[model samples]
Target: MTLLDGQVWTSDIYVDGWRPGRGEPWQVREPATGNIIGRVGTATTEDVAEAAAKAAKAQHAWQNTPYDERAAVLRRAGDLWNVHSGEVQEWLIREAGSIGPKAGLETHIAAQECFEAAALPSHPMGDVLPSTEPRWSMARRRPVGVVSVIAPFNFPLILSIRSVAPALALGNAVLLKPDPRTAVCGGVTLMRVFEEAGLPPGLLQMLPGGADIGQALVTTPEVRVVSFTGSTAAGQAVGELAGKHLKRAHLELGGNNALIVLPGADLERATSAGAFGSFMHQGQICMTTGRHLVHESMHDAYVEALASTASHLPVGDPHRGEVALGPIIDEKQVARIHRIVKSTVEAGARLAAGGTFEGPFYRPTVLAQMEPSMPAYTEEVFGPVAPVVPFSSHEEAIGLARRSEYGLSLGILGDVGTAMEIADSVPSGIVHINEQTVADEANVPFGGVGASGTGSRFGGPTANIEAFTETQWLTARPQIAPYPF
Candidate 1:
C-alpha cells in the first residue's frame, strides 16, 4: 500500500502490475516528525506528457456528458466524504500536523465544496446584440480540456478539490498532482467517492508524488491549463513553464498578510483574534496574519494580550481540541522559522514571548519594536510567530502594511468608515474588517495580488463558472443572400 524506491502506491494506477514508467517514486514525510509516512511515484516529464496525452484522447467524450449527470456524481462523492470525515481528519492531522478542530473543519469544508460544484452554470449564456436587421451575436463557455491541478502540502485536500471540482463540472478531465507529504490519503479517498458516485474511469485521476511529478504535469503538451498553489519560488518556476508551453495556469502562492489594530480598534477582540489566527496550525497558512500594525496608543496593550494568549497554548498531539497549537508541518519548516526569528532578532527586533522551536514544536511567539526589512517582517513567516510594529499615524500604518511580496489578504480593526478605507487601500484581493486575515467562508472570492497568488477560489458564480472553461463568440449576420455582398 506504500510506494518506495520509485514504486506506485495505489492499485488504481495499475492493472496487473503495470505502472507509468515516467512516475518514479518520491517520499512523503510527516510534518510533525521527519519520519517517512509513505512514498509514491513522482511523475517525470515524459510521465506528465503521457498523462496529458491520455487526457486529450479521452477528454472530449467526458465534456459531452450532461451537466446533471456530472453534478449527481459529485454530490454523491460529497455524501461519501461526509460519512467518512473522521478518517480523513485523522490523515490530515497525521500528515499535515494541524490539530483536531482545524483539520476537521478543513475536511468538512473541502468535502462539502465538492457538491458546491453542482451549482456551477452548465450552460453559460450569451445574448444577441439588439439590432434592427435581426443580426445576432452570442457567446458560449466551453471546456478548455485537460486541466492540471498542482496543490500545496498545507491544504492538499481543500486546494486539490477546489481546483479540480470546478474544472470537472465544466467538463474537463483533470490531472491532480497533490503535495507529496499529504498526498495519497485525502486525494485517494475523495476520488474513490467520485468513482462510487459514478465518475467514469479515467475522467478524474490523482497522481500523488513530488516536484518532478509536478513539473511533468505542467509542461505536458496536452494540458491546456494548470492550477497551482504553493510557495512564490515554486509558483514562479511553474508559471514560467506554463507560459513557455503556452498553457493557462491559476496560481495561489505565498503571503505575508497584515492585521492592523488602530487607536479605537477593539483591543480584546483584536488580541484574541491575533493569537488564534497567527498561531493556528503553527502558522503554516498562506493567509496567516504575520505583520501586525498597531497604533502607538494600543501598541503595548495589544502586544501584551497577544503574548498572554500565545504563552498558554498547549503543543503536542493534535487530536486534543484543547491543544490549541500543534506541530509545524515538519522539522525543515521548523528550521526555517528558527532562521527567520534569529535573523529578526539580529536585525534589532525584541522578542516579547516565543522565539525558539525544536523539531516541530515551535513556541507561539510575539515580537515588538520590529523592523520592516527583517525576513520575519517582509517575507511570509509560515510559523506560529507574530511580529508587532507600531505606527504613529494611520497613513504610516497603511504604508507599512503594503510592504510585502504577498498581497493575499488584509485585515482592519477600527471605526467602520476608516476600516473600509484601509481595506480599499490594501492591495490584497480579499479583505476582512474587524477580523483577522484568515477569516474566509465557503464561497467568497479569495486570492491575492503580487507574489501571493494568481487566481481566486470559492467564487460563488464567476470563479466556479469560468475557472476551467473557455468562451467562444458566435455571430449570425442576416442570412447573407447567396453570393451577394
Candidate 2:
C-alpha cells in the first residue's frame, strides 16, 4: 500500500495491521514553518500492552522459521529502502527537520543496517561446550521473544532500524516506539518497508506516542529486551525500569564528546573537521563534538577559522532551499539551545559567532574562551554550538576530555603518533584520528561508556547476537540416567 497518500489524516500506527490509533491523532508539523505536513495516529498505553502481547505470541513461530526465509525477508527490506528512497527522504525532511544530505545519509545507513542484519540469521547461533559428564553439551542462543525499540527524534530512521532490523533477523519480534515528532520517518516508514518485504503480521508493531507508551513498553512482561537511544536522563530511567522488570536494556544515550586539536595539526584541516563535527545536522546527534580542546599555541587561530566557517553555513528550510543546516527539531529544543548559549555567555564565555537564532533555525554558533565548568562546555548542547577551550599540554587536553560524564566519541587532529597516543589516554566508545567525532558504520559496535550508555553496544555480529538473544546451556545423553531416590 502507498504510505503517504496526499497528506490526508490516516491510521498510521501499526498493531496487528495498519489501523487507527486508539489515542488522538497527532498533526505532524514542519519544524521550519510549523505547518501541518501530515497527520498520524497516536498510541495509548493500553495499545502498547496489546501490541506487546501480540508480538510475543508471534515471535514463537518467527524464531522457528527457516533461517533462509528470515534472511530473505531482511534482504528484501534492505532493497525496499533504496526503492523508496525518495518517499522516505521527503518524510525525513518534513517530519524530522533534516537537511537534504542528512536525510539521504539516514536512508543509506538504514539500507546498510538491513543488509548487515540480513546476514545475522546465517551466523553461528551457539558454540559446543565440553562436559565433564558422559553427555554431549552445548550453549545455544535463543531469541528473547520480544524487543521494544525506543528511538529519538534525531536521525530517527538510522537509530530505530539499527536495532529493529537485527532483532527481527535474530528471530525476535519488535515493538517500536519512536518519538512522536518524527514518527512518520522513524516508525511508519519502517513498518511499510517490512510489511511490503513480506514481514508477517504482528512481527513488527509500531506504536508512536508519548512517555506513557514508552513506560508501558518497558513494564510490559511480553517485552524481553529494551533498546533505547535518547538522552541520558531518559535512558537512566528506562534502564532502571527495565532492570526492575528483569529485562536487558541496551542503551545508546547522550554525549558531550570532544575534538582535540594539537599544536602540530594543520590549522585549516583541523578547523574544518571541528566545524563539521559540531554543526552537522544542527548538532542534534549524540556523537556531535560538544567540546573543542585546542593547544594554546593554535587555540586563537582554530577558533577564528571555525567561527568563519560557521558564519558562512546557510541555515533555512531544507525543503525550500539547499541549506547547510535545517531547523532544530522543535521550538522547545530551539529555546533550550538558546538558553544554554545565553547562560554560557553570561557565565564568562565569549560568543565568537552566531549567538542569535531565527525561529527554529538556530545559527551555527561558536563559543571561545570557555571554561570546563560552564554550561555550554559541560552539558550536551544538542545544537549547532561549538565551545572552544584552550589547553597548554596534551595531559591537560586528555584530562579535559575525560571530565565529562559522557564518553561517547572523541576526535583528535594532529600527527598520527601524537593522536594515537592521546587517544590511548582518553576513554570513549569511538575515537577518530584526524577525523570528525560524528561517525558510524553498519558493521561496527556502536555505543558508549559511563553516562553515555550501558556499554552493551549495538551493531556488529557479536554485539547484536548478545543484545537480542539469551544464552542457554543444553546437554544430551544416550539414555536417561536414573538418580537414587
Candidate 3:
C-alpha cells in the first residue's frame, strides 16, 4: 500500500489500529496560505486512557521477544523512512511550513534516528556487580512499560521519533501525542511508517490533541515515562505532573541560545553563520541562536553584515516557491514575535533589518544594541528575529551568555584556544567552536540544562538507555544462608 493510505491520515487516532477519535474533528491548515489541507480526528482524555491501557498490555510480550527480532523491526522502519522520503518531505513542507532544505533535513534525520535506534536492541543491557555475600549479583536494564511522547510543532518528526523509536527498540510501547496544528506530519506519518514496518498492534498509539490530552498521558498510571519537547513553561508543568505521578519525564524544553563572535573572526563567515542560526526554519528550533554577542571593536561591522545577510534571504510559501524560510506556525506566533520586536525596539534597541510581516510570513529581523532586560533579549522568540549585543571583554561575553536562565547551546566563532577557554566557562549542555548553535546527530547525546530541559539527554546509546529503561539489581545463590538471630 502507499504511504498515505486512506485509513492512516484520515483517522483521528491509532489505538489497536487506525480509528476515529472520540473528540471533535480538527481541520489541519497550511500556515502560509491559511488553507485547510485535511480534517483529522482529535483525541480525548478517554482515548488517552484506553491507548495507555493497550500499551501497558502490549509491553510485556514485546519485551520478551528476541532481541534480534526487536532490532529487525527498527531496521525495517529505518528503511521505510528512506523509501518514502519524498512523500514525507512533502508533508513536512505543507503541514509544518518547512522550506525545501528544512523538509529534506527532517526526512533525512528521521531515517537516521531509526537506524541508530536499531542498534540499541543488541547493546549490552546490564553489568556484573561484586557482592559481599557468596552470590552472583548483577545490575540490569529493563524497559519502562509505556512511554508518552508529547512533541512540539517545530521539528516534530525529529523530536517525536528520537524518543519513540528508541523506546520501541528497547522493547517498550509508546503513546505519541503531537501538537494538533501539525499532527498529520508529526503523528500520522509516524504511525504509517511503523505500521508498514510490521510493528505489533497496540504497541504504538498516536493521539493528536491539545494540553488536556497531554495531561491525561502524564497522569495515566500505565505510562511510566513521559518524553516531552515544547516550551519551558509547558515542560515545567509536564515535569511537575509526571513527578506527582511518580513517573520519569524526559523534557527537552526551550532555549535562548547565544552565538558569540570573538576578535579576529571573519566578518563575512560570522554573519553567515549568525543569519542561518537565527533564521533557519524561521528560528523555531529549540537551539536557535537568540542572541549574538560580538566584541565591541567589531560589533558595528558585525551588525551591519548580519542585517545585510538577513535582509537578502527569501521568506514565502515553501510549497509555492523556493525560499530560505517559510511561514510562522500560526498567527498567534506571528503576534508574539511582533510584540517582542516592538517591545525591544521601544526599549532603546534599534531595528537594523526587518520588523514587518504580511500574513504568516515574518521577514528575517535583526535588532542591534540590545541589553539584558529587553524582551527580545530575554524571551525565547520562536521566530526569525536576531538580537545583537556588544561586549568589551571575554569576561563580559561570558557574563552576558550566563545571564539567562537557559543553558541549552552556545556557539563561539574565534581563535580555537580562546573559544575553547570561553566554552569551558559556559554552563550550556552543547557547545560548538566555529559553528552555529543549530546542530544535531543521531549518535550524539542531545539535550539542554537549567530552564532548557531536565538534563536527561536524548539520542546516543548511553543516554537513550538511561532515558527508556529502569535499573534492577539481582542476586542469586545455590542455597539460602541462615539468618543470624
Candidate 4:
C-alpha cells in the first residue's frame, strides 16, 4: 500500500494500458481542509479518442477469451482490494470526502461487486428456442464491444466498479473516466489492480478528465455502450449523446427519495432509520432520504426524536474513527445546501435543529412544517438536511411521495401487507419496508426511473448481462425450405 500523505499523488491516462498521460494535470484537493492532496492528469479530447480506439481494438480478443480466464481477472482484482483495504479506505476518506463507515462500506461493496461479477460467466446467457419447421434456433449474448464508464465522486470506487467489473466479466473492453476529485482512488488504483490481476493489457483504459472528455467518449464511434452514474443534468446530456449516436446507455442518476412513517410505526426504529438514511456521508448519496412523510398522528413526535438522534452523531474529520458525518465535497456545495435551508425556513418551514455549518461540515439538520412548494421539500437537498412533512392519510402520503420527477428509492414503515401494496404502486426502482432505501448488495438490480435515470439497470447477478451484452438470434436449417425466389 502506498502512503499519499504530504505527497502530490499523480496518475496518467491508461490508453490500451498504463502509460504517462500527455495532457495537463489537475490538482485534486481534500474537501475538508482545502489542501492539495494530489495532482491527476487530465485527458485531452485526443486522449479519449485514443483510449476508445485502443479499447475497440482490444475488445475482439478479450471477448473471445474463455469465461474462466475472464472470471479469474475479476477474482484476482477482488483479492488485491481485500489485501489493501486500509489504503483504499483512507483514499476514499480523503479524496471523496467520505466518513469512516462510508469509506469502509465503499471498499467492502466494491470487492463484493468484483466477486459477484466473476459469476457472470457462469450465468445463463444463451438459450435454445423451439421452431415449427425442421430447423434449429437459439439466441446468444454477445459483447457490446467497447464500454465507456463515467463515475461520480461520491462512492467513486464502488459506483465505478458496479459498472466496470460486470462489463469486463462479460468480455467488453472498458474505458473508465472517474471524477477528477477522486481520480487517484477511482482511476489509478483500479488500473493498478487490473494490471496486477493478470487482466490483458489494453483491455481496461482509465482516462481522468471533466465533461469534455466524457463527451468525447460518448460520441466516439468505436464505443457501443455507456454506463454513467452522476447528477440528473449530466445524465440527460449523456443520454442525448448516446441516443444520437445509436449506442446503448446504462444511466443511474439523481434521486429525491422519500421515507414515509405510518401511524403504527415504531418510533425508535423509525428515528434510527431516518437518521441513518438522511445523514450518511453527510447525505450525499443519491438515494439518501430527502423527504420524511410522517402520518399527522406521529409527525411531531417523530421530528423531536429524529432531532435528538441527529444531535448525538459526531461530525468532523473523516480520518478520525469516531466521526459520523464528514464535510461536504466543497464550500460551494455547503453554501448551496444552507441557502436552500434558509429559503425553506423563510417560506414557512421550521428548522427543528441544525441549520448551520462549521467550515465544510454542515450540521445534521431537521426541518419540519415543510410544504410541497419549498425548494428543500421539492428538490434534492443533497446534504445533511432531512425535511419532514405531515400527511393526513396513506393516500395523501403516497401522492406526496410520487410528486417528484425523480423516483429512485423509497422507504415505508407500515404493516407488511399495506407496505408491500404501496411499494408495488410506487414509481421508484428500489423500495424498502421498515428499512432505509439505500442498498449496496451484489445480487439486487439497482437503478432508477423517470428523471432519476434511463430504464437501464446494471447490478445483481442477472442484471449485468442485459446492459453489457446484446442478444443475437441464430437460425439453422437442416434442409432447404420451399423457396419463393
TM-score of 3: 0.99
Off by over 4 Å in 1: 1-24, 34-36, 121-123, 130-135, 319-322, 455-458, 476-485
lDDT of 1: 0.76
Measured over all alpha carbons after superposition, the RMSD of each candidate to the real structure, in angstroms, is 3.2, 1.2, 0.9, 1.9
Which sections of candidate 3 miss by over 4 Å?
none
Q: What is the TM-score of each candidate against the true structure?
A: 0.92, 0.98, 0.99, 0.96
Write out the backbone clash pairs for model 4. 16-202
Task: Give the per-residue lDDT digits (tens) of candidate 4, residues 47-82.
Answer: 888888878888899898989999999999888888
Worst 10 residues of 4 by lDDT: 1-10
Cα lDDT computed for each candidate against the true fold: 0.76, 0.92, 0.93, 0.87
lDDT of 3 by residue, 1-485 (tens): 67976555684688888889999988989999999988778999999999999999988999999999998999999998899999889889998999988888888888999999999999999999999999999999999899999999989899889999999999999999998898888888899999999999999999998899999999998999999999999999999999999998999999999999999999999999999999999999999999999999899999999888888999899999999999999999999999999999999999999999999999999999898899999999999999999999999999999989999999999899999989999999999999999999999998999999988569999999999999999999999877988
Candidate 2: residue 463 Cα off by (Å): 0.5
lDDT digits (tens) for residues 51-121 of candidate 1: 66776777888888877888777777777777777777777877778788887887787766776777674
Worst 10 residues of 1 by lDDT: 2-11
Model 2 clash pairs are none
**Total backbone collisions for each predicted model:** 4, 0, 1, 1
Question: Comparing 1 and 4 by TM-score, which wins?
Answer: 4
Give the C-alpha miss distance for residue 284 in model 2, angstroms.
Answer: 0.3
C-alpha lDDT of candidate 2 relative to the true structure? 0.92
Q: Which wins on TM-score, candidate 1 or candidate 2? A: 2
